[model samples]
Target: MSKKWSIAALVLYVVYAVGMYFYIFHGASGGVPATLKGTVADPQTFMTERELYLSDDYSKIRNFLFFVVTPFEWLVYFLILFMGISRVFEKWADTKWRLFKNGAYLFLLNLFTTIVFYPIDIYRYSLSKEYGISTQGFSSWMRDYVIDFWVNFGTTLLIVLVLYWLIQKSAKKWWLYAWLLTIPFAIFMMYLQPVVIDPLYNEFTPLKDKELEAKILSLADQADIPSDHVFEVDMSEKTNALNAYVTGIGGNSRIVLWDTTLNNLTDEEILFIMAHEMGHYVEKHIYIGIALYLLSMLVGLWLISKIMPWMVSKFGRVLNIEKVSDIRSLPLFLVLASFLLFISNPISNTVSRYQETRSDEYAMELTGDAEAAVSTFQNLAKAGLSEVNPPWLVKIFRYTHPPMLERINTIARYTDKNEVETEQQAE
Candidate 1:
C-alpha cells in the first residue's frame, strides 16, 4: 500500500513538473516587447516603462498562480510533517495518537525556534565567531533581526494588499492600469530602500582611508563612472562574506563595500573588487537584471492562473481551506513558484553566469591586473569554502558565476593575450 501510494505521488509530481514547465516557458504570448529592448535610452524613461509592464503583468499572473498552487503546497508540507513524525514514533514504540501529539509539540517547538532563536544562533555561531569578520554579538544581531523583520514584513504586506485591491477593483485589463498606479510606490521603495532599508541591517559609513579612496576614485574615473563617494558598510553584522556592490541609478548611484571585505583584503584586491562592481554599473547589469526578473514574474503568474483549478481539486481539502483568499492559500502559490523555478533553474543560472563572465572581463580590462584579480578569486573561493572545481552539470544547473578554476584560467588567458598584444605593439 505504501509503495502504491508512493507511485501515485510520484506520478502526480511528474505531472505537476510538466505542467509547470509549459506554464512558465510557454504562457507568455511573446518575448520581451521591442520598446523594452536593449539598454535604457534614458534611465528615468526606462525605469518608468519597466515598472509599468512589470506591475501590470505581475498582478494578472500572481492572482492566477496564487489560486492554482495553494493546495498542492499544503499537501506537500503536511506529508513531510507526517513522515517525519512517523519515523520518530517508530523508534519510541508510540501509538499513532501519541506520535501525533509529539509531532505537534515538535512542530511548534521548531517553528518557535525558527521565529526566535534561529536568528540568534546564526549570528552567534556563524557570523560573530568568524575571524577577520565584523563582530556582531547576540544582542546586536537580535536587534537587527527584529528591525529587519518588521520593516520587510510590513513592506511586503503593504504590497500584497495593494495588489489584492487592484485585482478586486480593476477590470481584466487591470494590469495595464495598475502599472500606472503602482510606479510611484515602486520608485519610492527603490529610493527609500538604500537609505532606510539597508541601514537597518548594517551600519553604513563613509570609507575613511584617503589614499585608498583616492585610488578607487582614480579607477572609477578611468572606467568613466561618475560617483561622489565610496562608502563602507559594516556587513560583519550578518556573515563573513566579502562583497562590494554598486547601487542606485543615475545621480543616486553609489558604491558600497563591506567592512569585512575591506579588513580582509589588500588595497589592490579591494581595487579589483571595486573594479568588478564598477563593471556591473558600467554594463548596466542592475537594470538588465530587474527587467529579466519582472518578465519572469509575469510569465510565472500567467502559468499559475492556468494551473490552480486542477491543483485545488486534488489537494485543497487537506489544508482545511476551501477558498483562495484564506491566507492559507499563500503557501500554495509559493510551492508552485518553487516547482516552476526548479525546472527553470538551468536557464536562469546560464543567464547569470553569462553576465558574470562579462563582468569579469570588464573587471580585468579596467584593473589591468589579471594576476591580482585571479588571486582575489582564489582567496574568495577559499574563504567561502566554495568547491575548487564542480562537475559540468552542477556548473550548468546551479552556479551563477563561473567556477573558481574557470575564472582563474580565463584571467590567465586574458593576461597572456594582453602581454602578446603589448609586445607586438612595442615591435
Candidate 2:
C-alpha cells in the first residue's frame, strides 16, 4: 500500500511539472490560437488616433481563452505559497507550527507597515542612508512619503480609469485604442516624473562645482547635445548604490548625477558612466525602448484577453466567481499575469541584454576610455554585491546586463592592447 501511494505521488508531481512547462512555454502560440496586426500609421500620428486592425471573431476567442487560463496560473501562486511554507518548516523543524505562525505574523506586520510606509520609506530608508549621497532623515522621509503616496495613487487611478474608459468606448480595435490612450500618459509621466515624483524621494540641488559642471557641459557640447542644466540628486537618502542617468525626452531631457555616484567614483569613471547614458540618448535607444515596450504590452494584452475566459471558468469555480471581471475575481487575474510574466522572463531578459550591450558599445566609442569603463563596472559589481560569474544559461535567461566577468573581459580586451603588443614585441 505504501509503495503504491509513493508511485501515485511521483505521478502527480510529473503531471504538475508537465502542466507548468506547457503553461509557461507552450500556452500562447504553441497550443492556443490568436491573431494580432498593427496598422501602418504615420510616424507623427498620435497613438490615440491610430486603429489596431484585429478580427472580431478572434477577439471573442481571445477573451474566452484568457478566462480559461487564469486559474491554472493562480495555482502556480498557490504552489509558491506552499513551497515557501514548506521551506520555513524545514528550517525550523523543532518549532514548525511556531514558524508558520511567525510567517502569518510577518504578513500582518508588513500589511500594517504599508499604511505607514510604502511611499515614505522610499525616501527615509532608501535615500537618506547613503553616507555622502543622502542627508535625509526620519522626519523628512515621513513627510515626503505621505505626500508622494496620495499624489501618485491619485494619478495612477486617474490614468487606469481613463484607459479603461478608452478601451470600452473607442474603436473596436481595443489594442489600437489602448495604445492611443497610453501616449499622453507616457508623455505626462516622462515630464512630471523627474520634476515632481523624484523630489519626493530626494532633494535635487543645482550642482555646486562650476569647474566640474563646466567640464561635463563641455563634453556634452562636443557631442552636439543641448542641455541647460545639470543637477545633483540626493540618492544617498535611500541607497548607497551609485548611478547616473540621462532622462526625459525631447526638450525635457536632463542629466541627473546621483550623490552616491559623485561621492564614490573618480571624475573619469563618472565621465565614462555619463557617456554610457549619453549613448542611450544619442543612439535613440530610449525612444526605441518605449516603442518596443508599448508594442509588446499590446500583444500581451491581446493574448491575455483571449485566454482569460476559459481560465475564469476553470479557476472561478474555486474562487466562487461567476464572471471574469467580478471584483472578487482579481486574485485569479493576478495569478494569470504572474504566469505570463514568468514565462516571458527569458524573452524579456534577452531583449534587454542585447540593448545593454549595444549601449555599452556606443559608450565605449564615445568615451574612448575602455579602462575607465571597465573599472566603473568593477566598482558597480563590488558595490552591488553582484556575482562576478554566472552560468551561461543563467546569464542568458536571467541577466539584464552581461555578467560582471564578461563585461570586464570585454573592456579589458579593448584597453589591454598595449600589454598584448608588448609581449609580441618581446617575442
- Top-TM-score structure, candidate number: 1
What is the lDDT, from 0 to 100, of the residue 308 in candidate 1? 50
lDDT of 1: 0.61
lDDT by residue (tens digit), candidate 2, 291-355 = 87677767766665666567656644434445543323333444555777756767778887767
In candidate 2, how many Å is residue 41 off?
Answer: 47
Candidate 1 on 1-427: residue-level lDDT in tens? 4344445665776676566445543452323335534422212222345444443344333323433344344445444323343234233433356334333433443343346445434643453244323356768776976776567556655654454445446524334454554556666666677787787677788898878999999999999989779999877766666788887665666788888788888998899989888888788888787677666766766676556545656655543334443233444555676778767778888888778878888889988887678678856754454433444444555578886656766777788899899999999
Query: TM-score of the candidate numbered 1?
Result: 0.68
RMSD in angstroms, candidate 1?
A: 14.8
For each candidate, what is the lDDT? 0.61, 0.58
